[model samples]
Target: MLGEFDVGGQQALLDAHALVIGLGGLGSPVALYLAAAGVGELTLVDHDTVDLTNLQRQIVHDHASLDRPKVESAAARINALNPDTRVTTITGRLEGSELDEAVAAADVVLDGTDNFASRYAINAAGIAAKTPLVSGAAIRLEGQVTVIDPRREDAPCYRCLYGDAGDEALNCAENGVAAPLVGIVGSVQAMEAMKIIADVGETLAGYVLYLDAKRMEWRKLKLNRDPDWPPRGGGGGPGAGLGGAGRGWIELDKYNRVKKPKHPWV
Candidate 1:
């Protein structure tokens, strides 16, 4: 049924492991989908316990999950979805050395955490560990998802976008979010994660997908590695596309169109 995925791709998912940070809005669907997709192992991390308020978009949890650690609750759902998946729960702030170790252990990392500091830390750890990070966030009526893979030469890290800009984004707790916005973002995150693990198809590798639910619009913003990134290297980095041959930052719309065909009987 999936022409893009062959036996090798399914096997790749079974042999891969993904580390998911945060088990709230974004993490909920990310974990569930990854498990259902047959990711071999998952390491779930979150320090918070499920609250009744989380039920709205944190679809992985239920009324019975209240007061339970988010990692535990999400694991329960993952297990029910696929009993073969190896689930590991870490109910603590995964930072410093612990975060580094976790990222190093997995084939890919999914970042669903909402705050800047946490995102920055996860980005640095993923870069250090040379693992891919599939990051997603939803707040208010908008959401965005991107893949930051240091392992992909010249690919940007999460810090490249926000290191200088700083994050003005507020958490869902401090703001109101449309119930399904996180679902859309999280599903995309999961899709990107599976692509990285299975090594199939083009991913959101060098682009960030932004969704504006108000107008129901989606935008793919090109990403450039920070000029000052890696700090010591000159501003120039690896060129976009394969083998540094691509012109920097191409506009996909121009190349991906087909003119209406001429009618023979016209």
Candidate 2:
């Protein structure tokens, strides 16, 4: 497949490390595909355990895996699928130095997390580490996916599109996502991550793909970087201007420093 696709620019997929920051719906497909595609290392992070509710969209977990840590279930499935891939499981929510350290060690990061706070934290880590991020989200009939590359000065980061508004996030638990919505978005995220690792084709670094499953329509929108947003590892300080809205600029470590509302969804 690599030879036919001319992927990785002579860099083998067997040497790449990918960090997936959730093991729920979106993370399920991303993890499975990356492992199947022969990514050498996968660092799976999630604080939640599998529930019967997650079986609707989270294909990585099954009846026997109920009540198990999502990372454990995901790792088991990945191992069963591809023994060549090494899986590292972090069983809890990663924050502070732990999150940054994981991102720093990875060749790429995939944001399958549900909330804005986690997304912001992951984006910050990716920027600081100069790693590419494949971000995906799904709620109800709507889904969106984008690629954020901190190495590209002109590319818009995740925060550039959605500021630090954790409270505003509508998760599947609340909004009730369609079963296949996450599958579609997560598959796209995996494709994007593989493209980045393989050095093949154009990535969605500056654009967001929106999927409206109800209407079965798709739209792509170009995103612009927020000028007031601080550079990678640059201090933005609390309350710094963030884009057009009155949203305050939160620092990279905001997730660790602040106490946030506990959302039920992963």
Candidate 3:
């Protein structure tokens, strides 16, 4: 076993609560490992259900779970893996007060949902709660992972990276993806979330870990802080995380609503 984490870290994991949004490919590995690692409680959220096509990478569900809500399928898997880990399931998207309440209750939040809409809303919720967020995405042969910690002023939030990229975030359904790609990214996400729960190691905050499966290589790219976001001071309070109007796009309209993701995300 790695010595970087000890009994105290193990205990920290046992006491930690992790909220995982999306019960699909990325969420599959994240939920399984978090439970296996002994995270005390987990809140699983997904508006979709399992389908025959999902078994490729959505390893949490099998044929028997098809037609079942993703959260329920994943919770069952998590319970089977670690009976002591308490699991809660939410059948739909978390928005407004519901979103904030969920993020506030968790020690860390994991974003495995596809689409910029869900990502942006989750980002805002994480920032508002000052919670650590571990986000992962995979499509085709590529994947990306990052940490946005509102607790750290210098760390960049989700909007900082994709604000100018517009509201478009691609998904596996629209674009073909290799089955194993999500597994790699999801595993890294699980590791990062566990590290946060255990209070060990430096997280990917301010850096995006990109993987190219075709080339089997990884690049850690630094994320620059947006000068206008979180509105410098009393304008939106310190670290409001989504306030500034620098990009010509309206933040209020964007954060206030989450469009349905192009694909069913886990």
Q: Model 3: how far is 61 from its true place, Å?
A: 0.4
lDDT of 2: 0.78
Please report, in order, the local distance difference test score of every candidate based on alpha carbons.
0.76, 0.78, 0.79
TM-score of each: 0.85, 0.86, 0.87
Ranking by lDDT: 3, 2, 1
User: How many residue pairs of model 1 clash at the backbone?
Assistant: 0
Between candidates 1 and 2, the TM-score winner:
2
List runs of model 2 lying over 4 Å from the truth.
2-4, 7-11, 231-260, 263-266
lDDT of 3 by residue, 1-266 (tens): 55766788888899999999998889999999899988999999999889999999999999999999999989888888999999999998788899889999999999988776678778888888899999998877878888998898787787776653343444578666788988888899999998887878899988778787889998886666677675311122222233343532243222121334544233
Q: What is the RMSD of candidate 1?
A: 11.5
TM-score quality measure for candidate 3: 0.87
- Model 3 misplacement above 4 A: 167-169, 231-266
Which 10-residue window of candidate 1 scores lowest in summed lDDT?
Answer: 257-266
Q: lDDT of model 1 at residue 168?
A: 32
